[model samples]
Target: MPLDTGQVDTGQVDIGQVDIGPLDTGPADLDLEEGNGVLNRDPLQSHASIGEALRAVRQDRGLTLDELAERTRVRRSYLEALEAMRLDALPSRPFTIGYIRAYALALGLDPEAAVERFKADEPVLDEPLRAPIGVPDERDPRVAAFIAGAVVIVVAIVLWNVAQRAMNASAPPPPKASEAQAWKLLAETRSGPVTLGPPLPAPVESTIPPLYETPGLAEAGPDGKGNDSAPANINDLSDAPLLDLTTLPATFTPKGKVYDSGNPQLGSLVTLQALNNAALIIRGTSGSVYFARQLAAGEAYKVPQLPGLTIDVSEPSDFQVFVAGQSKGVLPARQVLASKLAG
Candidate 1:
């Protein structure tokens, strides 16, 4: 039913027809345009970065990082890392993703959307390749056997060294040999005596008359008398001719200041005596060095009667050679080659 009211003049009132009908209950009209609708809001577009969005949402919810950590069961440091976008400060990718999801859930946000935003904001890193860790199989008997063998070998080596040291420590040292014994030993080890050439010719006798047999010397006396049985004047003997040393026997006398290699001999005992301190080397033709040392003054070395042996002296003038105890005099040169001394 409709009720019609007649016009009534009032300052701010006007009468009108009123119709009573069913009550209208419906949704209020809303502007559903591109940027004006609540359902069409872009969550990521509200902040400059994912970290800023997370911080803004947490701040809007009146929640501190400590409260968020308690709600999400994460450390406050990790929550601060997320809000600060310090991905390196957080854990690994998967663990960080879990932390982000938990944080978003505590802030009443979409966990998956937050994780996606976190992933988008995260920079790609070229992580180094790591070798996969292998778990050893303890059931293999060969491995245990190898380990035992290595241990046994190490222990055996240690014990062997210790035993060697102990034996060396307890063992008596060898007795020292005298110088004469050492020479005897050296002589015994050398080669046998060499065969020498034929013996040298006997010395020629001088035809000159003897000094005592001189005619005037035999008859003259101390009284200047021609007596047959008196001592002669000592001055009268000076008139006799001097004996020629060149005519002496080759056996007992020295050859000269130079050795005659023409007739090399391995005498009964050929010795080398140092007139002064000097170095000496006695080497054989076979390249065998029998003696090499500094010979003190007056020190002697018995030559090994070996054929084809040569002598070397640091100073030829400081050495003397002897054959059968008679000095033959100094060497001809510093080096007496095999042809010089052993021919």
Candidate 2:
């Protein structure tokens, strides 16, 4: 058979000249198999642990733990535990999975696939289901009575004001006096002018002696010309006895004890005060959160007396910590401050 060089036959084709687009370098989906009512049970699909895979991706991206923590907002210690596969050291299975997903995505890895890998490593505990709460019926008799009472009160108030206005309008006006009658009343009240009297002389001085005068005591300096010496000591006075402080009261008063700052000798009464509106978190030694909320300026929190506690603040300079009534200054931002009380 003869073929034309410029035109290809409809029945014949050249595989070398066909354009199939670019090659697919991405990974392929896992092969699925049906066994024991399960699909896609492949052992080779995930050989490395979730932490191992995440650590590899993170290292390949050349990111440090601190950098990833800043990006993901996960604690560096948590990330370290995740990388080390210390599941017991983590918060919980669900929280750890969430952390894994966030950490994996931060490193440019498939979060869903990473979560699946983590599920396989740790048992996924199902959260207990809670029933929805029911609201009270608004058509109840008590509610209707309350509403009716309120409406009656309002209507009574309106009606009382209307009645008060009507009564004021129906009342008679006060009587007005005529010009002739007013002049007659003024002439009857008028009287003669008052007589003048002469003024009396100033008061005379008394001749009684001062009650406080003494025989030997120098008279008060007369116009600053009398004695200029100091007053006699009260100890020289024989008429009055001095206070016997030594025998009157011999009770011993206890002195207040001074406490050291952040010392273990003091009782566990810890308090935290905020200088600015800021968010903070307080956790126990077991890593369980005891308090997590935003506090306004001058707001304070008295922590329950616990064996140990760790505090984390979003703003370091905005917080003032008190350990056993002693000021510990502001906490370091995003840093954990830990303390323990004496046994």
Candidate 3:
């Protein structure tokens, strides 16, 4: 459109109205798979009754309570309870079946027999424990005197063994003060070495031991393997062998019941002595100390880098402690370091 020069225009116009409603913008429309309405199930096997098992095995072998107890090291009272189906009378389940199975095996019965019996239904234990008859029960009041006498005998024997062991562990037989005084008087009277009864006779060929010898030079193939036919004439030397005393510890526990020095400590290092008059020392690894009781007499134990720490025992049946190759002292059933260890 053409506009004339110097023309001006001014005007205002109105707009139309609009309406708005609420809208759903939140997350939706999720389809979940429902689980099955019914679930699966299973059953367990019933355990064997303790009483039934004990009774069956005992009756099968015809063993009485006393005999069973002696064999299994279980008390007669416990075995009596197990047979009566009185599970509660026994201590714990582990202890109960353990003793029961041991008793069963002593009777040459099957272990499963015990398992079956352990799970069987049991009767209420309203009555006191009873022993199987015809065992000549030593616990009987009638034989109380005899049993007491027998026990005393056993105790005496045990004490005697302990006393003997104590004596052995002590120093070699010592001379009394009176004997020393007599020796002094005798020494004053003596001037020189006394002649032996008589000179020994020359050894006969039969009495002489034959010398050992090897044959002529062996042929070698440079591989270091020599022919046995000719083993090279090597001469043998004879002389008193030198002992490695440094390795022998002066303290030890002998292998005897007189005193079972406890086993070596676990994780402790130990040396296994060559049984024939041999001595060895080893550091305590955790396990070495647990087996110390297993060491025999004539064996030596030494601690590496610690000479004063040692144990020496002789007569595999007796316990003795020697320190620095000399006797420190003797310990009966238990040994403790009585004297101070030289630094």
Q: Global lDDT of each model?
A: 0.66, 0.64, 0.48
Q: Residue pairs in steric clash, candidate 1? A: none
In model 2, the Cα lDDT at residue 53 comes to 69
- Name the lDDT of candidate 2: 0.64
Q: What TM-score, over all chains together, does every model reach?
A: 0.28, 0.25, 0.20
Tell me the tens digit of each residue's lDDT in model 3 across 148-261.
999999999999999999989895987567888989889987967777787889878686677754443235533346644533222111111233445444544443322222
Q: Over 4 Å off in model 3, which ranges? A: 1-53, 120-343
Q: Is candidate 1 or candidate 3 better by lDDT?
A: 1
Task: Identify the leading candidate in terms of TM-score.
Answer: 1
| Candidate 2, poorest ten consecutive residues by summed lDDT | 251-260
Quote the lDDT for 186 in model 1.
92
Task: Give the alpha carbon lDDT tens digit for every residue of 137-234 in model 2.
Answer: 45778888999999999999999999999999999988999999999989877856767889888776987876986754566553334667654432
Task: Write candidate 1's Cα lDDT for 1-343 as tens digits.
Answer: 7888978776864334333223333222233544334222344435656678888888877988888888899999887887788876877789988987887788778889878877767766698965545656459889889999999999999999999999999999989999999999898979688789999999869878756655675456645586545543322322223444344333333322222222355432566667678898878888888778887776766666566677778876676655666655556566664333322
The Cα error of candidate 2 at residue 153, in Å, is 60
lDDT of 3 at 72: 87
